[model samples]
Target: MTATVTEQVFRLPDLGEGLTEAEILQWRVNVGDFVTVDQVVVEVETAKAAVDVPIPMAGKVVRLYGEPGTSVAVGAPLIAVAVPDERYREEERAGSGNVLVGYGTGGGGGRSRRRARVRQRQDEQPAASGPGKAASSSKSDPLLGPVSALEGGVSGAVVPSVSTSRLAGTPQAGEAAKPAETAGGKASGPGRKTAAKRMGEVPRVISPLVRRLAEEHGVDLTLVTPTGPRGVVLRRDVEAAIAASRNAETAQPEVAPAAAAPSHESAEAERVPLVGVRRAIAEKLSRSRREIPDATTWVDVDATALVELKESINRACPDARIGMLALLARICVVGLRRFPELNAYVDVERQEIVRLPHINLGFAAQTDRGLVVPVVHDAHRLTLAELAARLRELTADARDGKLTPQQLTGGTFTLNNYGVFGVDGSTPIINHPEAAMLGVGRIADRPWGYEGEVRLRKVTQLSFTFDHRVCDGGVAGGFLRFVADCVERPEVLITHL
Candidate 1:
């Protein structure tokens, strides 16, 4: 008699970086399509790059939870697969190893009898003899002697033994393993059974190229073991091995020719699909520009005194390490306090303007992933030293892709310092719902007539944009002038407070 098949749901794996979310770019396999283990099932665009997720088991896809363009959180079910026999289900519940799914590992089901036999056979075979038996023997033989060393001491490398335990285990070492007992020491569900069976079939071996390269480069492959399929050394594993060896060499390093040469054959422009944070930023900016009847007013201010102030403050408090951006943020906070109207947000749903008592100043930081606006919450409450420290923390988090949703939200006003890029000035779009945005331009030494005498002074441009319905040109201009006045004579800011 034939056994009945059961369907199990497969979830999206944590793509490392502790990223809890990702956007689905496309699905390679659809419902009812037969997929084998390690076959690419879907393409996902991570914050870092486009990556293909491999199917964990050989089965027919029964269902898909999301479509292209949909954003999904980690651990959310992505696909469903049907497996033959309740026996497979039973094995999954046995607390067996985990199966590789996409870029991560999932709880495994029971191992199949046939798979167990194959593994037994392979394990029984002598490690010294295999397809590359002659080569292995020759390399291992001490009589053959050591190979010639390269300029940097890179010589004959040996293929490292792969460690299946690491790949099957958690990404980090020393973490507590999940308990086998699932509600009274029985298998929690059928999904675990399927996961166990799949993991049992995965083969562990280092890639041939990685092994050869390791030997050629005199890299200790053992130091860079594979974390994929059994103990297969992946390309990344080999590269890491090489890097480790190079770092161990000398205090001062010599550059390698391979490192200097560009790897890509063509200088093709890489096209990035607009989605996630980039998409959200574009949509918000577009809506703000279209609906906010924005008008920008600029002011040229002598920032020479402000530069001197920053230098003196840095000397007094070496640990604080304050910067121009922090000073500008402080000035913006003071100006917002004076012109409380600019610190208000438009409540379109309620058809009313909501004024905020506390300042949440958003700083636009450019990251390799995209532009991120990390807000400095309760900016008004923070001192200059505290504000600088907070800004530094937020900037570092943003670049590292570690900022939380709260850090990216709830901004009454945004400050884009185009001066960092050496740009003079440009009109910046307002952050949606917020009434205004402030743009800081490059600070340069320019000739200015002060009391009928020409003198070189550090000058910068300030541009402010506000929603016309909430703020008229006069109000916007006054706000910009106030900021310029504070920056030009920064001492006035402290006195106003």
Candidate 2:
């Protein structure tokens, strides 16, 4: 008895933060591999961060839709999985009700299985390999499901637009097949020769995605030898061509780039793709500048006391090395309490200033990926030490690219520690929607008047940018003054608690 087979198509879902697309960083499974529900199948880098996507069902994967480094839009088909009819029936009866965000598992049902197409007058069957081999794969129906037609037996490439009926004429059965003649008089099978020419044929590719990829890579599809039905060039064929072209380039000896000499003509220019998180940042910053009528107020603070307090605490608890930024952040929370207008967003549509009850303090952290602000929720409620520990952990996580969407947003106010970059001060733009941002400059020994005597003190510049519409100079100055006083005195912060 021929066992029945069923296939399911899994589409990429929206990764949070209103992301429209994500680039496939890596795939965890390949064709013919069995996968369980909720198993992480692919790692994708979105506009915010890298995240893993889980498969929603248990089945044997028949085809993977995208290659690594390729961008796939949300709701686009990602992979196709096939399973036996009985297994599918069992899944339906038992109903493994697993669900994912934006996608849900309802009643399980099977889709129509693609039929087999036999080549006429073929002398022998092509060896089963890669995508062609399946649990129910057979000589008569060597093509197990839609994947063989879609991927054209190539791994990691999508070629779903091609129909199985259209692949170039397969060898007739019981008739001696003639191998295509090469320039060297060596005989090659029609399939292999067909693939060689399929890489250059653009019109033969029916998938819009495949065409776009061909255009991007500058692959002449007309020269591509089609391996799919009706002489259609598969996506894999285009990628293979690209890979071969790259290999040929690497095989040749490299010529030194003239950029090394730093000549005006040869000055090295590199173009980085402004996509994903970087693009999102650019758009957000641009929007902030475009929308917010922001103003700046700064003060040079005597941080000597704050520094000494941190040193004393560290000496007392050597295991917990308290960071200066943590102390400064605690002061910011206190300052926000005194001036709540700074911890709010202006609602232009509603014509209102929405003041938040709780403070979700965001701190600027620079990472290899880029600059990101990780938020500490309910920061106002935490003790100074607790705030310090959480800030340290969150900063480390941000630098390591492990922060989640929740940890990166919902901030009521921002504290920027530009001091780490060895800068003295900067009038930074406010983080959008939020009314203000506090920028801390580098701490350094500067001449100061201590007890009417000339002395050197640890001093730093504190730059504060606030939305002018939120409050006038008086409120902004008062907020900055309160923060500077806390930094200088350290004891004044106790009153806020």
Candidate 3:
């Protein structure tokens, strides 16, 4: 027998949340290029992040179904591959490399053990019925014969067509039997014309919501066996599959029971479809919340000096658009240095507090979708100008939804500038795993004691929430005081550096 070349198509992997589709950013390997397993084959941009998609199997790329910049649906063919090895085809038929099916190969390559067959009533047809009888039966009975053909065959050839004139002549039946063109022009077969007219009328098995959820979770709905009415894939079925995946992951060793609940929405929502960045953000935030204990404290500060300092800096660097928020972030880094305990996270599973030497500050920005905390790595080392430039770049990218996973991870502490919203002050939730969060309020003219004299001054409130389990009130209070002092004496921040 001639060696068969099994065509393999790689679909987009789950980018988290129901991010059903992605814009192909670039094709790393063009048609005919040989690629190895796990090689970066394409770059795709979802709403949440730009991700590099890897090749699942080593093969020669035969064709690309979609071009760069085009949005392709999840599970749609991305690239076709042809493996030269004959053994690869045999292995595939024997179910090797069927990772998508949840059965992965274990090093030694032999034919996969066959599964025990489950007897089905349909598989055992009436012994009295032969192929000829079945074919004749299918031709005569419009419902029984043709319907069997429609179910068994990929092509709809088994459907029979009736004359549209006969259908149209009967006001109701004619309306039902609309004109439908077949490959042969003439519509023949029972319900052929009706089926064609109703093809658009047929209720699709997958709903828009189901599709959206599947896309977010990077789930191949085709692989998800449906449990809905009429074999339609339901949203709940997809969610259950996701939950089962999480449960399996949690069962792994050395992980806390609480941490086992991999980040996802409550299984109770009417429609919780994992999609895009939202799904990823949910998982990370969930993990943080479960793994950390947080505490918060507030301090009112006179920001008159910092406001003046910003004006002075703006004058010195004409091109730099320095803002109070960036100045506040700089002070936070200086404060975190003095109180290093606040610049660490509690690894509950390991029962250890990780004290990071570098200060990677995460700034919370409000996006149209939700809150995203994009980080500035090594914030302590950067000068004011460098910090301002990096902050500007991060904020711009966060708003435009261009942030990568790297830019969002590894934050030792976070600052939520609620001040921009013109609010006086409110306690901000801790961006968990990190022990604390600082909320900055808007500066407004208020009466304050300066050198024992009550006078009008530009004042702002700062709410610092820390993980009390890790650090008590004294440590948390001291950290807040240090940050407030830095903001009050803007020059002190420069001295601390």
Candidate 4:
């Protein structure tokens, strides 16, 4: 079964919490492209949304799996990154306890650092800002943001703050210098090569599985030469070393074949793969229908006064942008406070209703990617302006595909303004694990009976869906009526405000 990599070389991220896979949406960084640590390598879509995935190493990408729209499972190898240099791979593997050379933090006190005295001429000293610190030529490495290193220079000196040292081996005072050290940190002279050979260092192995195989077979890695790109030890090399040790003379070195292609049976249909957030959504919705006895209740309300109040407030404070959604959010916050039972989930195993003390209000916002719910933490604590501002920020981030995982989950109750779609009402499914979801339909002009006569009024439909196991229509109806009254008479929110 092992074609190359011996099996499971490098794998995709483990999306814990029962999620087993992600579908590749697109590649942000291509093969042969150099990437820094934490650089976004790909944009992967889970059922929840499209999330930008970052690679955790500084290297040139050697390999990546599949084209866009490919579905990969957890623990599957997504890409193989060939690290930049031997020292980088070693330092990264051995852990940063022994600080790796050639890396500099930024400059200090507006002053550059003193360069290391490694093989530099006596008169070629750099200019010093004060008495102690010498000037440095520095540029930040993408691997570490704001992490400026000495240009062409590798330092062993401990300096304070960021490094603003001159480039390694760069002649500061216009003098000809010896051949600079190679990217492998090897000096030019024969004597330096001898010294490097004497030094003890760990062998460069990217895959943990490779190291494990070598250890299991009793093969010494230092004795085996590397064959992978950029001096990385591949699994085949280790296997070759093992064969040589066992047979000694009769065994020949074997090169591993490429990973086997999928059999014709693996070819799937045109249907969408059920995984990540999408699979999770399906399971949750299905479970909600199966486990929780749910019901929907609707009401029509006269929102003419709420609209008039919104206009008056907008005119009064032109600087503050308080939207209708924010007003509704505030109303929901108060309504939930009045009827707190709706702000809870079912503890299935314990057979109990878990009422949350704080509220994380999730509101639906549609973007080019798809519809998403961005949650507002502690919605009970935000003012109308604050709520509107947060909503604007989250919605903007959603549109730009920059929402964090935390912002997408942990919603206590949902506020769905389906009204934007030009619809009247919907039997909105409750966000699972959430006890309820409040849906607001389009508010339009309609004939209504006022105090003494028929008049044109702004009317909208409100639909409240809840878990019947948590409460009957009594509590659900009460919460709906409270929100409706608040919408009709905006002044009534003063007591809660």
TM-score of every model?
0.52, 0.72, 0.57, 0.58
Better of 3 and 4 by TM-score: 4
Q: What is the Å distance of residue 36 in model 1 from its true position?
A: 33
Candidate ranking (TM-score, best to worst): 2, 4, 3, 1
Off by over 4 Å in 3: 1-47, 50-78, 81-275, 278-290
Number of backbone-clashing residue pairs for each candidate, in the order shown:
16, 28, 26, 16
Which 10-residue window of candidate 2 scores lowest in summed lDDT? 115-124
| Residue 449 accuracy (lDDT) in model 1 | 77
Question: Mind giving the per-residue lDDT tens digits that candidate 1 earns over 1-497?
Answer: 44455555567776643255565666798655676656778777555334567755555565555445445566766666666645434544443333323333233332322222222233323423333222211112121122111111111111225343332232223333341223354334434323433444222333334445667777654455555433444555666766666555533444598777545443334334354567667777788877788878888889998999999999999999999999999988988888888899778788898889889999999988888888999999998999999999999987877665557777899999989999888888888878888998899999987768999999888888888878777778877888888888887887977
Please give, for residues 183-224, the per-residue lDDT of candidate 2 as tens digits: 555445555455435433133323544566778878776676
Predicted candidate 3 versus true structure: per-residue lDDT over 24-81, tens digit per residue:
6677876546766667787887756676776656655544644443456666556666
Q: Write the per-residue lDDT of candidate 4 for residues 1-497, one digit (tens) a residue.
A: 21111111235665433445566666787544676655677787666666666655555454455445445666565655544345344435644221212112110121112222322322134322222334353444343223223222212111123121221223455444433233466454534323423453334322443555777878776666767543445566877887667665444455456754543433322323343455566787787787777799999999999998888888998766878898999999999999999999999999899999999999988877566788999999988888889988998998887775567878899999999999999998888889999999999999999998999999999999999988999999999998988998988886667
Model 4 residue 453 CA deviation (Å) reads 2.6
Candidate 2's C-alpha runs over 4 A off are 1-8, 81-103, 106-199, 203-265
Query: Number of the top candidate by lDDT?
Result: 2
Cα distance off (Å), candidate 4, residue 64: 2.9
Give me the displacement of residue 421 in model 4, in angstroms: 2.7
Q: What are the lDDT figures for the candidates, one per model?
A: 0.65, 0.72, 0.64, 0.65
